[model samples]
Target: MKNSLKLLLSSALLLTLAACQGQDVATLNLEGGDNIVGGSKVSSWSDLSKHVLSILTGPGERIQICTAVLIRDNIALTAAHCVYQKNKIRIAYGVDLYEQGNEIPVDKVVIHELYGGPGSGRNDLALIRIAGNLPRKYKPVALPSVADTPYQGQELITVGYGRTGWMKGAENDGRLRQVAVNVDSTDMNKIWIGRSNGKGICQGDSGGPTFLKKNGEYYPIGIASYILMMSDDPAKKCLEGGVLMNVVSYLPWIHQNLPSLN
Candidate 1:
């Protein structure tokens, strides 16, 4: 079953544990380079910690995933694939995934009508509605109505509950790390090149927010969709780099379908 799951989504898992493992903070080379990520870079993990969340099935279930910020207080955003398999999806606030903490039940799920597979090249966004008011500690991140396009040397930050380590034994440890990678280009939804060669969004980091740091403010620009591990083919729909759908490009569809996501 696990093998089948990976084949379907191309998600990499650390063998010793179910947690994800692809990239880390130390790997990011934030200095200016060939691929510009954003206009600025993230200041600290403290500023973006609230945006990180654990998407789980129960207090201690194996079927857990990671997600990221969308709105200020009411809505939680993630990949359509995360909520599709199970309806009883819950968002756990704070860094740890094991504790019940301030976990909140998701009352409703709104997926894009045109959403296909994770590789379908369509809208892959989903908005999860909590049953009641959100906890004070779990503040939301703001989604930009519009975003500035990426340049050659601009830096960007990606935060999520992905694998803390790049090896098998440390999967699912549930520590959120931020990596600063320069965006190579935004040709389509497929190929996203980064200056930091070893940094990227892994399996568990799916649906996490990719921030465009500008003038000390982080804007939700894209949702982490897929990561490219071994290619440089520009003609392919997916490449050997990370793939993130532009949230700013789909703003109209997102707001019209899931107002809470706005």
Candidate 2:
């Protein structure tokens, strides 16, 4: 069963990547190990911790395949690639997979106009508006100042419900997890993270939140974009590093679409 699931996921990723060929941006299908590489499972949920959510695509099977972050009572921030498809997108809030927490139907989705398709990873952002307000436990994460810049070697925290291992067929436990990743480098619109330590983002983590701690408060700085493969292993895990779409770079677009949240 696990092997079948992995194969299906790989095929889906390949199809998405193939569709993006010829674009200036780099592209790679989604593949990951058991969970967030080198990260630990979160045993409990924090007050704002529920801000991180699992995104389920498709209609019948409804797989909890991607992660997203709540930025307002009704608005969520996620990778454009995650919602590029025509399938129904649902948001699950909570730490456990079996708990059947609040599941909200997405009322509308707004992908960045310039998003260069799924694998391009350029302008990779989207805003999802739920049909109604979120519960009290779920709170929006604060956005970073557009002027802020990530520096190399700076410590950052990532939270998501993604796969756990680098080996093939490693399963996602469906539990929310957190990991500390150091910023390896940065560009005008992206932040690269990870190193030999193995701690980094993985498949099913796309659209999750990358946070910057300031004055002891966590602020959303980037959205999980894609993995930067450094190996030719068939497993296709994030052995090299990962890329994050700098949230600051899209502040104007975000504010323009969700002006009420700003």
Candidates in order: C-alpha RMSD to true structure:
8.7, 4.5
* Worst ten in a row by lDDT for model 1: 29-38
For model 2, residues 36-87, the per-residue Cα lDDT tens digits are: 7777776655643667877767654334367888888778898887787635
For each candidate in the order shown, give its overall lDDT on alpha carbons. Answer: 0.55, 0.71
**Measured by C-alpha RMSD in angstroms, how accurate is candidate 1?**
8.7
lDDT value, residue 75 of candidate 1: 77
Q: Output the number of the lDDT-best candidate.
A: 2
> Can you give the lDDT of residue 197 in candidate 2?
89
Q: Deviation in angstroms for 75 in model 1?
A: 0.5
Task: Please give, for residues 1-262, the per-residue lDDT of candidate 1 as tens digits.
Answer: 3333222112223221232123332222110001112222223247776666656542222344557574747677766666665465777665544333456777788887777764454566777777676556556666676547555556778777645333434344444566776677775443264525555565466677778877777787777765553432322211235666677777777677665433
